[model samples]
Structure formats: structure tokens, C-alpha cells
Target chain A: MVAIADSVPKPVARFRFILDRRNVLGSIMIAPAILYVLLLVGVPFLMAVYYSLSAYTIYDPSWSFVGLANFEDVVQDPVFQQTLYNTFIFTFGSQMLGLILGKFGALVLLRPFPGRKFVRALVILPWAVPIALATVAWQWMFDSLYSVINWTLIALGVVTRSQAPNWLGTPHLAMLSVIVVNAWRFFPFAIVIFLAGITAVPQDVLDAATVDGAGFWRRNYQIIMPMILPIVAIGLVFGIVFTFTDLSIVFLMTMGGPVGATSVLGFAGFQTGIVSGDVSHGAAISLFMLPVLFIVVVAMLRFIRRREV
Target chain B: MGSGGNKNNRSVTRRSFLKASGAIGGAAGLAPVLSAPFVSRAVADNKSLSIVQWSHFVPAYDTWFDKFAKDWGDKNKIAVTVDHVPVQDVPARAAAEVSAQSGHDLFGFNGSGGAHLYRKFFINLADLVKETEKKFGQVTTIGKQLGYNADDGSWSAFPDFYINFPGMYQKSLWDGIGMKPDTWDNLRIGGAKLKAKGKPVGISLGHSNDPSTTWRGLLWSYGGAIQDAAGKKVVLDSKEAIEAAKFVAALYKEAMTPEVLSWNDSSNNQYLASGVASYIVNPISAYRTIQQSNKKLADDIFVIEPPKGPAKQIMGAASEFYGIWKFAKNKEAALEFLKYYRDHWPEAFKASEGYNNPCFANLVPKPMPILANDPTSTPPTKMAILQDSDKWSAIPGYPGPATPATDEIYYAFILNDMMTKTATGQSSAEDSVKMATQRCEAIFRKWARRT
Candidate 1:
């Protein structure tokens, strides 16, 4: 018996034959993704670069080519320097705190216990809920006049009403507050990464380590950590990238204040580009993040590729 | 062979029928898409207007304004749409609209109008201004400066209303302290006493409009400004500016809490309504809010002129204006709508509960009936102080037009940060002034080249 497809039209058969080609099929499959990235990411990125090299502003969309003048100007700015410094501190502080919390959280969840699934679901809430809503809720908690933290502290006689700490007001405290909120938002993601890496370690390997007289600490730090380093490193790359470029928490919580204590490159870019309407300088400020993030991604990806098991 | 032939014929018929149906269905599906441009053009060419503005702090104002817009649309046989965004999001929203080069026909500037900043995207409103002036007389000084370009002699926006920033104080708190905040000295002294008693004055020191306006008032009151009257130079590093910074630092240290450093535009309003605040610099919306939420506190709240400083007693006013975008599709309708809206200024003011002060001198004349005898107010005349507020009011970049330079500085919160730095002991008054001056010089120089 002949195949039913044999009766198909010559054009349809020819088109199916072309679709069946491996390279063509592969290309067609990824066409949407490539188009998505090109349109959304590539176009905007190129536009930003173009804007950075020009004297474009919302008031005057002249697009006059200025040739690095904006970068030179922002580089010389004392505030921009402060912003750069704050960005590093914010990113490092949040990433470190997140990874540490995530490691411990994963270890806790790893042990079999009652209501483990429920507890795991709760851990995912911070990462799952909408960030804007969460940030607004945090804003109220850190409010100057009605901070719940201050209320509790005062109630506990830890501090008087007059002396209660202003979390989002004082420069140091504001920085610390933003870092804490960012870490809280990012830790759940880290926890999942850690859980995956830990579970991927074979039981036989653990059993062999145990037989070799390796203790919990020894296995965790010396054996398991090195084994999981590649995955954790990948997670760290994402965490750093997200935390470093974050604008929402800072914007909604402190607005880069009390005197730009919590100002980061992303927030500064938005303030300059959007609020101040200096598009060229804003583009420059935002583009400054690229090199740092690029380096991180390259290093982690290289490490991941080398450690692929 | 005959049966096989019949099966093949039936199969071909079904396929042909499917192709015919698909062609018909495809046309049906694409009909709306293909005709959309013509439909939109027909609507856009006539009888349509759209507006975007900050959602008023007073809820009743938005309700009344939307209804007013719909009524006007109905009367004119036009389709009108209104969009409201949070006050804090207005600048970003405007920036987005300008970037896209397409948005509502008329855009409302709620605070210090950005007519000068985004002037290129806005239509020249000089003719509208002249027409309004012919009927209602000259616009108020601050109103004109807020939306007019001195160089081109063009009005970039039509001045609508100004919100008077008064000294909203807790009557009982001041009475208990045996003082009133009539002057800067008295404000500091009384505020300190109140602070010692656990009731501190609340004014924003953060990057929001409240701080932007309030700090400018303080700066001007000390004989300092961001620019000279020519609006050509940065004059923020003056001795008087240093003094203003020093005075504010002292005030912050002695009279206010550190929390004020994180306050937004609405924070002070919330602070005043909380009953723990002795004083706050805000519009009548604060009092209006408490009237609905806390009547007892509302009764204790009263408005007064902003504290008189050593040099002058000008108050920083938050003005509202409307600009027609250059890319607007319904220019004629928008202009007509604005004229109609202007004719109903008194009604708009009433809808705002007297919060909206007319920019036209004759639009809502002196001793405004609603303000002088507000039935909703506790004493029925408590809001009378705002009747003559325009006399003491100054827009952003006072002593000069609101130029691109001042727009940059105001939105950047440069002055607010300078004050905050000194007040928080992060920088000395001189250093803060110097730093802020550097920032302002950069901005002024940039705008100088462009303008």
C-alpha cells in the first residue's frame, strides 16, 4: 500500500521535504526566539548606545552627535562616582547575603520533616510574588513616620521613639535596608538553585565520602561545595546581574536618597534619563553597567562549560 | 474502480469547500485590521480629544473633572478620553509620551509645569493665552513664568490652576507651645519646643515635589536662588544660600526627626493627619483629607502663610497647566475644549473644594466665595488665607522663568539633596552649597548651549 502522503500535492510534498531538513527545521524552530531578542533586546541596546553618543534629551530630541561628551561629563561628576561605589556595595552585599541564606535554607529544606512541601512553597513566595507589590509593602514597613520595625523596637524598649532608627532616611541605614530587601527577594531563587545542585550529587558519592570519614561540614565545604561550585557560580552570576542592575527597590523605597545614599547606576540612569530628561547622560549611566555584567557572565559561563558533567 | 473514483471525488470536493470557507473566514478575520486605519483616521480627523494628567490628591476633583470632560464631549459631539496617573509618575509618564511622539492631545502638568522642559513637543499656546488675556486680563506672574518662554515670546502651555502651599499647623500643638509659625525664626523655635515635647514638624527632605517646592521657598526666603533673573547663570553658591543651608540644618537638628529625610510628597500630609506633627508645608488637600478621615484633627488644623524669612516671604506654589502636544490629532477640538474648560474655572475650583486656584486674575477674583466661606471647613472661614496666596506665591525657578536648567535641577532634587546633606550632617553647609552649585552649573551650562 502506498503512503497516504504520496497523494498530497507536489507543492505540499516539496514544502514538507524542505521542512524535514535538519538545519532548516532547527532554524525555523528558533526563528521566533531570535526575532524576539533582536527586536526587544538588540534594538534597544543599539539605541541606547546611539543615544549615549549623542546629545539627545526629551526636551530637545535633536540627536546631535556629541562623541563621548556625556560619558566624560558623567565620569567627572562626583555624584556619579558615588553612584558607582554604591552600586558595587549594593550588588556584593545583596549577592553574598542571598547566597549564604540560600545555602542554609536549602540545607534545612533538604532534611525530611513534616510539612516540608508547604514550607518549600512558603520559601518560594518571595520570588513568586510580584516585585512591585512586594516593594510597596516593604516601603510601608520602612516608612519614616509609621515604620513597623521602629514600632516594635520602641515597644520592646530597644529604642525610644525619638531615637528609633530611620531605616530609609539615614544614608548608611538606607543602603543597608535596600540591600536587605534585595537579598530577601533574591534568596528564594538561590535556594532553588542550591537545592538542585545538592540533589544532583549522587547518594553513592555521599556514601563514599562518609565511608572515607568525611563529616557533614567536611562534605559540605570540601566535597559538595567544589562539586556544586559550577552551578552555584551560575546562580551567583544571575544574582549579581539582577541585584547590580536593580532599580525598583531603591526607587520605591529610598528614591536614591537621603542624599543619594542608596543610589545605584540603574536608579541614577532612570533619574537622569527619565526624570531629568537628559537622555544622553542617562544612556551613558545605564551603559556603564554592561562591562561589569559582561565580565561576570563570561567568567561564570566559562567555568560552567569547563565543569559540565 | 467506480467506488474508488467516487471516494476521490468526495475527498476533492471537501478540500475545495474547506479552501473556499477558509478564504471567506480569512477575509472576515482581516476586515477589521484592514479598515482600522481608515476608521481611526475618520475619528482622529474630527471629534476626538484625549487628556493625561496626575490623579488629583483630592478624589472629588478627579470625579468632577472626568464628568466635566464627558459633559463637554457630549455637548460638542466629540469623543473624549481622560487618563490619570499618580502624581509621582507624571514626569516619567510625560517622558514616555514624548519619546513615543504620540499620546493624548492635551497633557496636564500638575506641579511646576514642564512647559519649558518639554516645550519642543508642545504646541505654541501664545494665541490661546492672548485670547484668554483679552477676556480675563493678564495671567498671574508665576503662572506666566511657569509656562512662557522669555526668549521666543511663546506660551508653551495654558495656565490653569495653582495649589497654594500654606503652613498647615495643628492649632492645639501651636497653642500649647505658646507660639505660631509666622516667621522662620518662630517656626524653628516653636518647632523645637514641640519636638522636645515629642511633636515634631514634618517637612519632606527627600526627592519629591513637596521637598522640591518647600526647599525653594526656603532658599528664596534667604535671598538665594538657583539662577539670576536673567536665567542665564548658576547663582546657588552664594553666601545667602549657605546661610539658608545652615538655617535648615539647624532646623532639622533641633526640630525635625530623621524620618523626614525619607518622606515623599504625601508623607507630610500623612504626618499632619497623624496628629503627632505640629506643622507641615502642604496644600489644602492635607486638611481636606483629614476632614474626611479624621474630623477632630481637621478642626484643629488651620492654614497660614508660609513663614516669613529674613529676605522675603514668598511661598513656593504648585501650579497646574495644560499643553497641547505637537503630534496631537485633535488640535482644534483640544483648543476648543480648553477654552470651554477655562470658561468654567469657577466650577472647577468648587469641584476641587477651593484647592484649585485660578491662574487668570479675573477668572476667580479676590475673596473667592468658596474659600472665604467654605461650608465643609470647621470654622467655615478657615481656608480664607489661600484667597490671596498668589500674591506671595512663586513658581519653580522664581526670580526667573522656569527654564530647562531649572527644570533639570528641580526634578533632579539637587536643592533637596543639598538641604538634606547639611541637615543630616553628611556635609557642611558650605560644602553642600558648593556641591549643589557644581551640579547646577553643569546643568545650566548644558541647557545654556541648547537654548
Candidate 2:
């Protein structure tokens, strides 16, 4: 039967003989992407994971298999614990502030008001400015001796002549200052997202709710909020991730100082790995965030999925 | 025949697909590899030197390599180029370059990071010095001292410049208050007057890597140090350390702005430039920075040897020693460049506009141009002030010692955190010092064991 089929030009044989242009085009299209992901993402990620398990100090080229030693050291470190606490505080504080301010700003700007375009552009100014420049500007504004805020407070009799507030000196205040800076810098992103979400709300449903004697608070809380929950969740996730992982602001602003008061995990990792030449310890510190970040991401994804369902 | 043709077509299509995929893969991977050879060739062909050095050093020396380049290149048919990088990023950049085994031909570093970490990356300059000295009639004593070694001449550092932290005060401010801050105690009294005049005496209690230097100076002046003569163990928790801490705490309480804790690395310059602080312990770099920003403070600002403490000893931090990379492709050229930098001290000093202090004892015999007592250059009293620098100035680890671990602890933990705790009233000086000492001991032991 095989010999007979080979001899005969059957319809199936004819179809198989023709080139599948779709398959060729599909392979050609995906070739670059496959190569990109493997080279860029897969290779580096594998290296990072491999390095994470090894004692890879930049000072020394000789790396030994330390197993989970780096992780154990990180867990045992008091500085790591402090860093975790600071990271959480920074992430949560900045995200919450960003959410509130961003939503409010979005709502106010959503309506057709005078100078709305100008105000919208101004709102984005903080986000648009380079992080280093913005942090430097904030550092100057919060200067201990000659801060504009201190001068204003003193002039207004809010603070006494001798009671100048050290905005970035004390630990608590330094943390607060960094959180404020992060919130100010990133809130514009939230605003833009929230604004898009708000605009996407159905006008008919809102009108119906208003006709049913729903007040602004009721309409916003019950109607508009549920509709925009997914967007808000996305904004929150991004805010948390960005804040938790950020080092530049803390580095430039305070360097996690005034006694490690504002030392976040990201900054700690950088300080240990790069600054102090303790790559193993730095890697350990950086990986400490994995579990917490995993928990955050998982929780957010579940919420979004549930909302979608 | 038809079946054979069909089989051949399928095989060709598969081969073509594989070839296409392979081409894409090769293109993606080949860029960095292809560029590597070119980079290597460029590095080999280039006779020009690029250095990431301290900002202050650039002004101190005239990089008149154009003449040398023309002469040397004409003689040897090789060209030379030089560029400077900001000092702060030098260590990290050098580390990256060294790890990659690429980048700058030379990098300048300070004593702490330069000696501790950068040493591992740098080539031993002992032979280079010996060879250069054989030709140049014995290299400068400072260079030899910086590169000295008893264990088969394994030293790597090449001494470039040195500066001491003198108590830079507004002389007019002190004289106007009828208060002389000759001693550490006197600073408290002077600080009180300054505070009364609504200007708190500025001192850098700021959390910074430099804080270790400040703390060490205070500790040394109080007869305390991170280690003793033997350099066997940590001594940060001693009575003198406690006393120094208490003194600093009191000073902070009375004289310093609350903002000192948050001040950036440049805060010392800011304090003096704004005329808010009456005194600060800074290098001549601070003086230069302030003069550049506000020239009015040039004469009003005075440099005094660090005030005497309970121990009656004045102490200050020394700047970093410049070293050549061990794996530097142009090691000979780098050494030659350093030799040029050292030999032309007078020219370098004149070019720097008298900002850099010469490391060589002979070259700085009477204090170079701007530091001289000549009426045309600077005030006679101004030159007189630097006279005590030779006596008071000492590197953190000097007189047969290396305290890399202690220095690291001092910067990373003690100065960055402990100082703030004491100053902010969060912890007592004794408690802070005690805790810091225990921490320092652990680190020192760990490091000692490793080395």
C-alpha cells in the first residue's frame, strides 16, 4: 500500500507537497522574540539565581557553593529586619498616600473646570522631573538650617523662633520625608490611571444613580468605585512594587541614615552588595524581599481575578 | 521521482527555517562579542590615559600632557590623552571596570575604600616604583612611603596628595565674640555665643561616609582610636571614646543645627558657604569649595589645627592614596603618568591655584604658592595657620597599622548610626559607644580571621 501511495499523486499528497506559507511566516515572526526572551530575560535571570546561591563577592572572583547560607545570614541579620520594616512602611505609606491624593486629583480634574488642562499638566510636573533632580530639590527645601518650610513655619508663628524642625535629621522624620517624596513623585501616575478609569465609567449609570437620589458620596463609593476597582488595584500594585523596589530616592535623599531609620531593603542590598563589597550579603538582603513581594503580587492578582470573574 | 522531489523540498524548507533561526540567534549574540575585540584593540592602540580621580586633584595639577604627548609621542611615536571623572563615583566605576577587566587606565581613591577594597583590584606598584626610581634617582619619599613593603615589596598605592582636617572657623566671628575656640571645650563656649547671636556653630554630624573621619578625629583627639599600637583588637568603647562622644553630644545639643543629621555630603561646604556655621572640620577642599562659591570667606575663614581634647592630641583624616590597576594594560605608562604628576609638583600646585597640598615633604618645604606667606598670594597669618599640619596630621591607620575592618565598621555602622543616636538623645554616649565597640569587635574578628 505504501508503494502504491508513493506512485500515485493523491489529493493529500498534493496538499503536503505544497509549502505552508503560514507556518514559515509564523516561524519567522516568532524567531526574533524567542531569541530576545532567551538572551535577555532567561539568561540573566538564570545567572542572577545562580549567583544568588553562590558567595559572589565582587572583590573576590572565587565563588563557592554556599547553599542557603546567604539566605540564612539575611534572615538572621538585624539590619535586614529593619530594612524589611522600612520597606513595608515606605511601600504602604507611599501607595496609600498616592491612592488618596491621586484619586482626589483625578476627580477634581475630571470635570470641565477653568484651567483644567494647565492644572493637569502641572500635576504631572513632579512625575516628569528626573528622580535625582527632584530629590535634590526636595533635599534643599527640607534643609535643616535654611529650609523654606522652616522659615515659613517660623514666620507664621506655627513654630517658635528656636523650634526649627529638622525635617530629615531624626529617623521618623527622615522616613516620613522619603515617603512624602515618593508619594509626590509617583502620585501623578496614579492620577493618570485613575483619571482614565473615572472617564471610562458609564455616564448613563451615573445619571441613573443621581436620579435615584444618590448623593455624591453614595454615587462615588457605591457606583463609581466598584466600576474602577480594577484600575485602582493596578495602580496600587504598581505603587507598591515601585516603592518597595526603589533605591534612588532614598540613596540621594537620606542614604538610609540618621541611624538606618529610613534604610529600606533595596537600599540595604545596594549598600551591602555594591558599596560595602559584600555581594553575598547584599544578594541575601535583596532576596529577603522575594517572599513579601510574592505575597503582595499574589494577593493583588487574586483580587483582580476575582473582580474579573 | 515526484516523491523524491517532495522529500527534497521538505528537507530544504526545514533547513532554510533552521538556517534563518540560526542567523537570528547569531546576530543577537554576536554584537557584544564582536564589539569586544574592537574595544580591546582600541584600548591597546590608545596611549591616552583616562582617570576617575578626586575633583580637588584636577585643579591642583596642570595636565600639561600636550607637551609630554608631543615630545613622548614624537620620540616614541605614541599619542596620549587624559580625562578626569568625579571622585565620588570613582570606586564603583573602578570596581565595575576591573571586574569586567576594562575601562580607565587610572583611578584615584581615598584611604578608606581605596586602600581597603581598591587594593584588591590594583597592581603592585613596588616594581614600577623601583624601576622608575632607578631611572629617576629615587622616587619622592612620600611615594616610597605610600608604596613601602617589608613582605617582598607587595605594596600597590602611589601617594599623590595629602590634606588634614583643620578646624576652619570664621576668625572674625570668634574674635567678635571675644571667644577663642583654641580647645574643644572652648568650642562649646564659642558655640554658645554663636547660638546667642542666632547662628549655631555648624559641625557635620550628618550621616555620611565622611562621618567616620570626623568621629575618628574626635576619638583621636580624646586619646581614643579604633585600634591600639598592635592593631590586634577594637578599642572604640574606651573611656576616651565615651568622653569624646559625650563632648560631641554636648556640642550638638548646644551649637549644631538640628539639620546636621540630614545634611548631604556637601553640607560642610554649604554650612560654611552660607555663613551659618562658625566652624567645621574639613579638608582644604572645603575651603576651596567655599572660596569658589563665596570669595568673601577667603580671609574671614581661618584654618586651625583640630582643637585639643582631653588627651591634648589633635587628629585629622588624610585623603586617599592613588594606585594603578594591577591588570592595567598600560602599567608602565600609568606609572610614568604618576611620575609626571609627582615631579611637576610646583606646576601642578600653580595650576591647582594652590588648592591641593603636595604630598612630598621636599616640594612643600615652605608651603607652595597660595599657602605661602607672600603678601601677593595670601595673608602671612594664613600661611602660618598651616604650619601645624605636619605635626597634627595622621592617617587613620598610621605608625605600623592597618584598620580596614575597623574603618569599615566606623563608617557603615558607628558614625552612620551611633553618632546620630547620641546626638538625637536616643541613646547615651556610653551606651552607643559600648554597643558600637561590641559590633566593631565582631566585624574586626570576622575580618581578621578572613585575612
Candidate 3:
């Protein structure tokens, strides 16, 4: 042991050697990024946790430590429960629909077809549009009186002029509209990811599958799908996270209205924290989703590992 | 070997000391240097004054602000710029600025209760009032009328404009019904007739941000008060309130379309513009929009004082008041700009093009004639609605002081749940009121202590 220690050299000497010119330069190069994350992200995350445990108002200077009172209140609050349920519905509904549409869209575009490139380009239009402008356009399309949809329906004689439906007035319908809008806006991302995944599937595998007498759907399900399952899962996770936290669509479109049918966790956080000036409650509401989010992330990681195995 | 080792040790010590000291210095110096730009920018920009006020107030009062800015710049050697933001963003944006401890010299908000809710961020205009009144005769008259004593001089805001939310209808439609709506009960009958004729009457019954103003207007018209004079209690569950709720529910059942539950600030205007509805309980702003947007309809539209209820005739007052930021670097300039705005009322009124009526009774002897000839103004009848506004206007929190909980209850409970449930027939009017009252009492109790 003494001989090995002597051969290894003194701790100070080892430290000096590790901090030699090359390593020092590398450390210096990465320092800014490290410090940036530490200051901006790490500090704020710590502060958010601290605030979640306290009763703080931006309007008032006095911040009292309320322990788990805010969390308890959030659990008891009916609005919070409704918002949580809406958030889950919005995220899951949009992600599933988006994935299916995106996958199908990518497959359709993959085949040599007329105006394939143009169609692919057009597919991205919804994603390209600004949320505010898109929401406003949707608002016009769904207008109770002058909606294009209503006009079209009336013109087609599918519905009488007097029977024009109020698309955003009904509670269930409003939730459906928001989910549809969210799916429309985010589905292009899924399409792009799935397209990349599909492209990565070796042409040799397809040739082999064809030689094995596998049909198109059979080949897709057996070979292409298993190969890209990880990517699809990744896309699903991202979609769920984005939809769960989104506020602009619901805020600008329905404002969590039509009797709070569209209210989600994100909207509740914004209203409670920013609008009502109850920062603690808002922080608490946001933290309410942390455990669920953690579970999803862990599940996603486990799924990816299983896929690798 | 000894010479080389001593040389290495000297170099290492010097380098280590330099690096440690440099890091310490950098960390220490970072905050001030980074903060300098913000501080210097604010100081350098001190000569300039920025205002976020109602759209009508800025455009209508354009010549006044322009002339005043030029004159004030020449006289006081300070440049001033006025900007207009929509009315809805005024409160939220102002609150954000206050939180950031920056932005805007003068910010205008909707009502007295709103002003009080954000009182912590505002400078007491008492000193400014003395300075202004000494220079100009009176910069604001409504301030005095609203119990803001310019003599004792504890004013925080300068009252700018006033609006009344009463029942407005298409005069042609009402005339077709062969009955004029003179009382509050007349709304139900007229609305039913309109519905029979295939038109739904539009009324806002939602838990929107503006619910307090909209629903409170209906409540007061029915002789319901949120509280008595002291404002220290909640009286929203009173018999009068229940009666008003029942009446509203009946109106919703008979005449109003399902869309009323989804209406927000722009819904009433949209309803009138699209001709989807014939009558609505809304502010003059809606009437002004219709008049400007569609002249043909403007001629047929008539504004009526709120219908007399079983107990009284009441209307909700929608007004904008100006307050200087307490943390403003240029408080004197902000006050001067406000004074200049007030002094040039005639030009301001002209600029508003009859959209905004001055709250100061003296500045506006009567409503500005609707500029029907100018083609930009709403029709003559639309402009005539201002007269009705004067007769029946209740300030928010009227009969009592406005509380945050009062606004919250108005939005969250009464508008969102009770109104929707009542309209949808999910709950009876009494049950809706009962649920709303229970929720309101909880909120009021929580916030009353805070106030």
C-alpha cells in the first residue's frame, strides 16, 4: 500500500497535475455556461420551492412561512381539482391525437405523391403561425353569429340558419375546442420527429421484411414501430409536458371560461399567482404537478432503457 | 535544482493570489456594473414622461397632449411622450411595472375601487393637487365630487371619464314590440318579445374579469347593494340580491342565448355589431363602438336609463382615473402632465370624438353632439345615450367601499358559478344565490381582514 501510494504521488501534486494548462483552459471555457445555469435556473428553482412553502404576495412585503398550508388549501380547492383534471385531459387528449395524426401524415407524405413537398410544407403552417394570431383567427371562425363554420353549415343545408351552434358557449365543447387547437398547433413537431425516426429505419430491414412476405401494415408494426418506439415515447413525453403547462391557447381562446370548463392547472397558477397576486398559492399549484411530472419522467426513462435492452 | 524549485514556488504563489483576488473583485463589481445601465437609463430618460391611458382619452385628447408636451418642453425644458394602451391592460401592466419598480410615469385605471386596490403603488396627489390648483383653477372636478377633498388635499387619483351600463336596445326593435322599456321589468317583457321574433337579447352573465362591474350593475338596478355605507360587511345575500338574481335568471331563460355565459369585455359589442342580439345591459363603450362601427345601426339604437326595479333605479358607473406612481422619478412632471390634460378638456373631448364623456360636469355641460355629419361619429341617437348615463350611474362598490374579495366574489362565484348555473337551469335562482352567498362570505371574510 505504501509503495502504491508513493507511486501515485502526493494529493497536492495530483491536484496540480489535474489542473494543468489544458484542463484549466477547458474549465475556463465551460465556466460561463455552468455559472449561467447555476444563477438563472438553480437559484430560481430553489427559490420556487422556498416560496411554495410560504404565504407570499407580491403586493405585500410580509412573507410568512405557512408550512404546508398552501398545499392543503390547493388540495381542498374545487377549482384546483377541476384544473388538474382539465390539464390531464388536455395533455393526454392532444398528445394521443397529435401522435396518430403526425404518424399518419408522415407516412402519407413519405410515398411519392403529387405535391408531396408542398403538402409537407403546408403541414407546418399551423406550427408556424403565432399563437395570438391563430387564437384570434379561431375566434373568428367560431364566432356565434358570423362563424365561417356556421356559414358553411348553413350553406350546405346541414343546419338551418336559426340553428347555428354556439361553438364556445357550451362547456364540454369549449374544452374540446381548446384541445383541438393545441393539437393543431403542436402536431407538426410530432410529424417532424416521426419523420426523422422513419428515415433512420434502415432500407435493408424493409427489403428483408418484404422478402419475408410481411405486408405494409405488418412490416410497419413489427419492424418500423419497434425501432422507433423510443422516439415516439419521447415525443409523447414532450407533448404531454408542453400541453400541461400551456396557457396562451386557453387564456386567449376561452380564458378558462364558458363556466371555467377550460381552466387547467397552468391557468389556475397564473390567475392565483399573477392575477390575484397570491404568489404562494400559485407556486403551490405549480408544485402540485411536480410529483406527477417526476413520475412521468421516471417512467419515460425506464421505457427508454427497456427499449435499449 | 534549488534555484528552479524557488522560481516555481514564486510563480505559483503570485498566480494563485492574482486569480483569487481577480475572482473576488469580479464578483463584487458585477452587481453595480450590471445595475448601472438600468439606473442611468432611467435617470437619463427622466426628462421624458410616458403615460398609458385609455385609447379614447389619448386619441380624443391628442391635440391637447401634443400641444401640452410641446409647451411644457419649451417652458420646463423636459420632453414628454404619451402612449395609449387598451383599458384592459392598464391594471395588469401597471401592477407589473410596480413589481419591477419601473415603467410609466402616469397610469390610468378604470374606477375608484381599482385605484384603491393598488393604492400602495400610487403617490398621494394631495401635494400635486395644491400645486396644480394654485396654478390652474381646478384640474379635476369629479375628485371633489367623489369626496376627494382637494382642500384637505388627500387625493390619490384624478377622475377622467364616466360611463353608465344601462339597458341599450335597437330603437327599431323596441318600437316594433309596440312598447317602450321604461322600467327594469320591461326588459324581461321586451326581451321575450324580441326572442319571439327570432332574436335573442344579449346580457353578460359570466365570471369574467369584468364580472364585478357587469353583474353589480344589474344588481344595483334591482335595488340590491353589496354592502351598506360603512363597507365593513357583506350584504350580497339580501332579499333584494336574491330578487335581482331571480329576475336575471328569468330574463336568461326567456330571452338570452346560451352565449351569455361566455361573454367577456368584447362580447356585448360583438353581439350588437353582428346583430345577433337586440338588447343588452352594457356600458356606453359598447354603444360608442356600435355607433362608430355601423352608422346605419347606430341610428336605430337607443340608450335607456336602467329599468326601474322593485326597489330603485340604479346604474353602474364605469370611469377612468389617473394616478402618479409613487416610485416615479419625475413625480412633478407627472402631476404637470395630468394638470395639462385636465386644463385642455375641450380639445381632449374633441379628440375623443364623443366616445369619452368627461366626469367633470363643468367641462362637459352636456354630451357632445354625435358627429353624424362627420361620418366618424356614431349616429345622433347613440350620442344621446350620454344623457341617460348621467341620471343613473353607480360607482363600483357603491353604497360601500370596494374590496378585493368583493371583486373576487363577483368574478369567481356569482359570475362563474351562480350566473352560469342559473342561466343553464342547472340550479334554481335561489340555490344559485345561496351558493354564491356562501362562497362570497368566505372570500369577503378572508379579504376584509387584509384591507
Candidate 2's residue-wise lDDT over A1-309, tens digit each?
Answer: 655667676776656655356787678789999999999978866665666677676556446777886677667556567889999999899888888889899889988988999999999999999998999899888887678988999999999856877888877888888999999998899899989998999899999999999999998999989989988888888888778889998888887777888889888887666665666666677777777888998999899989989
Q: In order, what lDDT does every prediction score? A: 0.88, 0.71, 0.71
Tell me the tens digit of each residue's lDDT in model 3 across A1-309. Answer: 534554554676777877787978799889999999999979977777877787566545346787997788678666668888889888888888888888898898789989989999999999999998999898777766567988999999999876877777788878888888888888899899889999999999999999989999998899999999998888888888778878888778777777678888887787666655566777888877778888997899799889989
lDDT of 1 by residue, B1-451 (tens): 3333434445556678999999999999998899997788566545788999989977889999999999999877788899999877888888888878888999998656388888888899999999999888788998788788877899899998888899989899899978999998899999999999989989889978889899899999999999888778889999999999999998998899888888888899998888989999998888888999998999999999999989999878888899999999889889999999998888898898888888888988767877999887889999888888988889887898877678778877899999998888888999999999999999888776666
lDDT of 1: 0.88
Q: Interface RMSD (Å), each candidate?
A: 4.5, 5.4, 6.6
Tell me the TM-score of each prediction against the true structure. Answer: 0.93, 0.84, 0.83
Residue B85: error of model 2 in Å?
A: 3.3
**Candidate 3 global TM-score:** 0.83
Best by DockQ: 1
DockQ of each: 0.53, 0.31, 0.19
**Alpha-carbon shift of residue B412 in model 3 (angstroms):** 3.7
Show where candidate 2 strays beyond 4 Å: A1-52, B1-46, B57-83, B129-152, B230-232, B289-297, B374-378, B387-390, B397-404, B410-413
CAPRI-wise, candidate 3 is incorrect
Over 4 Å off, model 3: A1-40, B1-46, B54-71, B128-154, B207-212, B360-363, B366-391, B410-413
Residue lDDT tens for model 3, B1-451:
3323334345556678999999999988897787886788565555877777656533435565566666766576677677767664555676588778988888776644555556567777766555545654454333443325323446657667665566678888888888777775787888888888876788766545445565676687667776665666767677777777777778888887776766666777788877767887776566667766787886677777677777667666567778888888778888887776677766665666654566554555454544223354444344465554555666655666544555454435344566677768777877777767766665565454445
Output the better candidate (1/2) by TM-score. Answer: 1
Worst 10 residues of 1 chain A by lDDT: A1-10
